[model samples]
Target: MSDNFPPPPPEQPQPEPERPVPVQPSPWAAPAAPPGKQRTGLIVTLAVGGGLVVAGAVVALVYAAMSSVQDSIALPPRSETPYSEPYEEEPYEEEPYAEGPSATEADAKKDVTITACTRDPQIGWQSAKVKVVNGSSTTASYTIMMEFLDEDGVKVAEGGAGVVDLEPGASAVKKAQGLGEVPPGTTCRIGDVWRTPSDRSGS
Candidate 1:
């Protein structure tokens, strides 16, 4: 009877507690970088810096070469005085002309006409120019005489004594030199007559 009572008490069941599931790490988590890869990036940065330094040196050398080339070029020396045309010993001659009308009258018919004329002051002497017209029907020969006068109406210098011949309806030029000094005056005039030395001294 005691063995049958103990077997009847073994019928009660027992319950177990619930356990949580284990989680796996994310796939996108950063990995440990390789030492060789890190060293490669450092080498690339150093190479870029070295290349920039080389480029800067090359640019500096180029600039120095250009400056040296510029300095080596030769240039002519400059002059302080204003330049003028060289003086010629021989006087200029004009073309031959033919006479058609007198140069005195304003309405006189002329075969030739004066084109251009000017004058320039020199350091020691004064220069002048004149153009003459042939106003005649036939060819004629003539001479131009320039007389420089002082304020007292006295002739000082004389220029142009050579003969000038002009073709019909042509123009000519006459150049000459003076024997005395040039004087200053408010009024100026062009004349055909030339005063001789004896005549000037006599007056």
Candidate 2:
């Protein structure tokens, strides 16, 4: 029996599941920055900083060198000479001056005679004993000068004495002293003698 059952409804084809739509990138999202550009900028900044450090070091070295050169070229002080040994000064010595009888004593030497010279044992003074005879016709007085002399003949002291009026041809002895501090071995002698005739008109 050929019963015609409706051919099973035309074989239905199963619809394939829809493929997943590729997600399109959203237009509102921020774009990623390039790493290369960032790295290049950092490198440039570092280079500039290193260059400044090197330049500063070079400038400092130049300044130090200039200072050293100036110090080496500077001149020393004008009075910088140093003595090797301490300076010593020499001692001064004085020479004794030579002395002799003065003009008046020289003139009187012819008229006077020195009898003796002596030094006082107690007082350390020098004295002279002189004796003179009046040769004039009238009464005369005598003025005598005595001098103390050192061994070198330097006149150390001087004194004077007077013999009052005496008759002519009379002899008188007078002692005269030289007052001063004298060196040892000092001697005294008559230096000058002046004879003056007495003036009787006023007397």
Candidate 3:
């Protein structure tokens, strides 16, 4: 029977139970990182840091450019000056000596007598009226030269008046003015007188 049927297996021995090993902690040992999650977190952190750096650089550059532009277009400093009050101007006044009669009116020749002499306030001139008498029997024309003398008796100005076509024993009135301003307290006199043939008819 042992030969024909495989003899029953001999009884097997039971295996012993495994015991937990005691592990020693190393001084340099650290927490082990999760492979997938740690890598992803490190990449995100680097990206954020890089963006902040770039943004800071860009802001610095922009600030530098603006400062440069402002400097280039800056205005010059203004100079300070002392202020003073304005001065008033005086009005003009005319001298009293600006009025008088011309020399021609005061000293006419014997043929001419000055009847009136005056200073015109409006025109600022010396004027005179004179009467010329034709003493010659024949018709004649007469000219009288006048001189204006300053207070010192120096001749300062001169002028003349004339009458034309005077008949014998007839008279005519003439007017004259000085060429220049007459000095104050100046005297006027007839410097000379002359006669010429008159073509005019009887008086």
Candidate 4:
């Protein structure tokens, strides 16, 4: 018998003691977070920085728009002069009458004189007669204005008469008629006398 028992199973090698694997952290795995307080502080810092960048961009855009609007608008020019009050006009004053004798009074004194005046009543008219004397040296024509006065000395009617070509120092009768009735107690007087150069031959 050749020791045919399967050669006694080769002496099995004694099992080596199992060694523990060194646990190396994986490269892609997320790192373990720190304490709760430190982690909250890191998140707050990142948020504040992001907000600042966004605010800066908004401010830049607003400033550019405002600049463009200001350049496009036109403003009116300012005046250098100060304000002044309106001009006012002065009030007007009237001139007073001059003190002197009128032209008619001077002509009457130098040319003729009235000697007598009379008024007589006719059918439908009251006739006035005036006696005039030419005081000037030359032959003259005369006009006599007569006024009729009532008893109270108030004038009621007036008329005029003309004498043509009376010689110097000559007397002439001139007559006129008033159309209305002559009231009672009425008297007549010469009101005015005017004289001019005569065209007729004088005696």
Candidate 5:
């Protein structure tokens, strides 16, 4: 190899092919859903949640309103109301006292004495008598009326008799009879008779 002569050019090595690098796919890069479907799902979820909240609020409001109404209500007092009617009641009635026997001072052409015979009930025929006494110096006239009252105070019988121009102290005997049943609970007595029927009825 002469110095002056150029050395043979060094042999150039050929470059080796580059190896392919392994790449990892990104996790956030999934396929997107349709816009309409995504929007529909979001709307449905919100609607359900809003409906539940609204329902709860409505229930609370209703309960509060009812409670307030009940507290505000008031009732009337029972004692303030009147229970009885404002009218008068019927009157009481009783038996007649003119049904038995009586005596007067105007009978027997002289003076007579009137008296009561029996005050109690008689089994069959009942009678009372009177006596004649000449007590007055002048003639006397007698007009006597009698009534009978039973146990129940009802009028069972009544009668009357009269003696005109009796001599002084002259007496007469008279009796009354009837066919009515006597009730219990009262006693018998001879009643005085007035001249008028209205008086007798009222008595």
Candidate 6:
């Protein structure tokens, strides 16, 4: 019996299975960006299958919408220049005047004559140029008044100027200004004149 089975060959030595190799961990690397962020507006291709007779690919189409973007900001309104009007001085009623003119003043006004009546180009007020002659026999000073009147003779403005130390029978020119702004076609004239005697004897 032993010859027939021929004692089983001595068990051959079995080589030890190879120890699993510990693959060195690849150097730490940054993870890829999420699909939503990376795949936008891009075309992608994919393949599936190893057992089929013909090579085939699974085509998945991901549509990404594209649109134009515009940036704008609101701004405040622009500033404009303000309106301007003609200038005016104090009102005519604010002037100092008595109820009535004295006899000498009324007589002196006759000696004062208005030469030119016009509007001031710079201040836009009425003005009058008057010639005052000291017709009395003594040295005197005179204050002459100007009145601005509308076409209907309505007084609109009044002003005055003084001529001092005028000798007897001597003449002088002075400008009288109007206080208020008069209308178009308005007239200016000498309103009144008052004389002050400084010396009894002619000087």
Instruction: Give per-model TM-scores.
Output: 0.32, 0.44, 0.42, 0.41, 0.28, 0.46
Q: Which candidate is the best by lDDT?
A: 2
Q: Rate the local accuracy (lDDT) of all candidates.
A: 0.53, 0.75, 0.74, 0.70, 0.53, 0.73
Which lDDT value does model 3 have at 179? Answer: 74
- Candidate 4 stretches with Cα past 4 Å from truth are 1-103, 106-125, 199-203
Model 2 local distance difference test score:
0.75
Total backbone clashes of candidate 3, pairs 3 or more residues apart or in separate chains: 4
How far off is residue 196 in model 2, in Å?
Answer: 1.4
Tell me each candidate's RMSD, in Å, in order.
Answer: 20.2, 19.8, 20.3, 20.5, 16.3, 21.8
Candidate 3 deviant stretches above 4 angstroms: 1-108, 199-203
Steric overlap count per candidate: 18, 0, 4, 0, 22, 0
Number of clashing residue pairs, candidate 4: 0
Task: For model 6, state the Cα shift of residue 202 in Å.
Answer: 14
Instruction: Sort all candidates by TM-score, best to worst.
Output: 6, 2, 3, 4, 1, 5
What's the lDDT for residue 63 in model 4?
99
Model 2 lDDT tens row, 1-203: 87877766777799999999998878998765599988998999999999999999999999999999998996866986776887798888866433321234344344456677777777777877777677668776778888888999999998777777778778777778779767779877676666666766788
lDDT of 4 at 158: 79
Off by over 4 Å in 5: 1-128, 131-137, 178-188, 193-203
Off by over 4 Å in 6: 1-104, 200-203
In candidate 4, what are the lDDT values of residues 1-203, reduced to their tens digit? 77666656668789999999999999999888779967898989999999999999999999999999998888788988999998898887866434322224555544544444444544434456666677768777776677777789988887788877778888776676555666767777667766776645443
Minimum summed lDDT over a 10-residue window in model 5 is located at 193-202
